[model samples]
Target: MLFAPLSELYGRTRIYHIANVGFIAFLIGCALAPTLNALIIFRFLSGVFGSCPVTNGGGSISDMIIQQHRGAAMAGFSIGPLLGPIIGPVVGGIVAERLSWRWVFWVLVILSSLLSLVFLAFSRETYAPVLLQRKTDRLRRENINNNINNNAAALLRSKLDAGLTPRELFLRAILRPFKLLVFSPICAICNVFVGIAYGYLYIMFTSITPLFEQQYGFDGVRAGLAFLGLGVGSMLGVAYFSSASDRYIKKKAKEAGDLAADDDDGDGEEGMVRRRPSVGAIKPEYRLPPLRLGAVLLPVGLFIYGWTAQYKVHWIVPIIGTTIMGSLQLYLVDTFTIYAASALAANSVVRSLLGAVLPLAGGPMYEKLGLGWGNSLLAFIAVALIPVPWLFMRYGEFLRKRFAIENL
Candidate 1:
């Protein structure tokens, strides 16, 4: 939350660098801490600072890329984080087995430090507001240097006068996410759906170990191998979404063009009126198609996975179910998050919050219900909410109109 506001207030590059440094420092502290309390405190602090990337990543996407091309960028961005858990255990196990647990923190610090340097060196300021402010300053300085005491200079100065003060932008940036949560029904609803999906994913992450070990009599390495199915499925899912997303948008645009041609009169103005419903202006709801598909796949996959495991069916059967569920989970997470950002300004705070809270509920939930009934319970709730994306897709414009939130 703190990082989100700061990134918006200033710019992404600076926040990225600052956060990265703080994150690395905390990692070092975690590695060197003599006491568990110190390690725990440092770990908590590291998480707080480490969140800057995800919080600011969407804004950077908006700044640096056109909407049509963002699918690929978002897909690439989504892959790294989504794959971490699947890969983390595999590596962490080896590292912990071979070296002390402190080595885990030390190794991460080393790798992250190198990555942070690359990011700091390569990344430029991409936030539009920040870029514009810099441009305005440059123009003003150049004008003064040239002694261009004319209407142009006066106009530029007036524009600068009307622009937001640093204090004002800071306040707005900090408050915008909260405002959306309170005032925007779409944001609130979407956040809930995404959070549930995320929580369920984390639940699987925690429960998979015990499920394989106790239920299937699998050892540490084989149990770890179970996550490989999810990793492969998630990669395939990303491939599906990334490969088709841009094409889908273009196809919709082409169809919209055809419809506009049919509605065209002698003049372009009337045609534009008719074209409003078409892809001349792509709506945020375009991001939801994958989400709509995900709603169906998520529950069905969960049911199959859970029941198949419960019944001690062929091991491959449950694995296949997880593969499907894992793939769909990635698609849903990416889509819901991107859609939410599109629907509400500075709403990445909601994503950050969702990411943080979802995993915490998984362990207890699995403990109580066990793998079969626990996942089934989740599937039931998920199935019940399947209509959510559809409803938003169909009536989104109407809801947006009625709610009438400004600058959304």
Candidate 2:
């Protein structure tokens, strides 16, 4: 959340560079820590600083890509975060077994440094306001240098940006997400939904070591390889959603084309038609899986994965279940494209907290309730919330208009 707002308030590139440096420094701190306490502290700091890219990434994408084409862009961008888990387990297992546990931090440090260098060479500030602020600064410099006292554009920009103090901007960056989360039902529900899915994924991560190692008696390397099913599932989810979202939007646009007059700046989901846009707007529900596919598939996936793992069914069966549940929260970006940073940051808080805390309960829950019942409990939660997206589909605009955050 801090980084998300900071990127918009300051320059996105500057925030990334600072966060990268902080992340690397903390990783090095972890690699050389003298005690477990120190290591834990360093690890926490590393996560805090390292997450800057993800927090700001949605907003940057919003700045660069129109909503019409963002789904495809997000698919390519999401591959890293979604598929990243597959790499983490394998890399950590190999590095710890071959070298030492501390070497894991060293490996991350090296990779992060390389990424930082790449960003330094290529990454540019993508936020529009910050770019304009830079232009304003240049105009100020030029006006002063040339003694131009009555530059209309410069005066207007200065007046427009007049109360934008650093402290005020910082507060906006930090507080806006919370405001959206608290005041906007759409934002809140979406975050909670995404958070649960994210937490479920982490819970699966915690389960993998024990579930595969003990149940199947897999060797260490093979246990790490257990995550491959999920990796494949994640990729499948991304591919299907990307294609489905684009197809759905295009179809909706074709049907709504009569309402569109030129519609040059019309972003499909935002306002696809200029004439009577409210009636022709592509609803957020259009981004959802048609016929409640995601709603049913999520719980179904949990049931299959749980029961299969419970009864020692064929590994492939569980993999197939995982494939069904691996799909997750991409539509929120489309739902609030201009405020994508605040929107994603809202999820960041819920998802990060849930992702961290839920896994801690995984071991005890699985031990007490066993895999089948434990997963059934989660599936029950999913089933209960099935109406969330549907409700939005039917009444999202009314709710959005009625509870508009700025009004509050």
Using lDDT as the measure, the top candidate is: 2
Each prediction's TM-score against the native?
0.87, 0.88
Per-residue alpha-carbon lDDT of model 1 for 1-408, expressed as tens digits?
Answer: 566657666677888999999999999999999999999999999988887786667668867777677776787787777788887777776787789789989999999999998987888898765566566667667766555544454555574343666677667656766677788787778777777776677767877777778878987767777887788878987887776676677667666666655444556465355543342266767777777777888898899889888888877778887787888766676666566564334344555466567667766776787668877988999999899988998997777668666742
Worst 10 residues of 2 by lDDT: 331-340
lDDT of each: 0.74, 0.75
Highest-TM-score candidate: 2
Which residue pairs come into collision in candidate 2?
A: none
Clashes of 2: 0
lDDT of 2 by residue, 139-159 (tens): 777766544533644554564
Return the lDDT, model 2, position 305.
Answer: 86
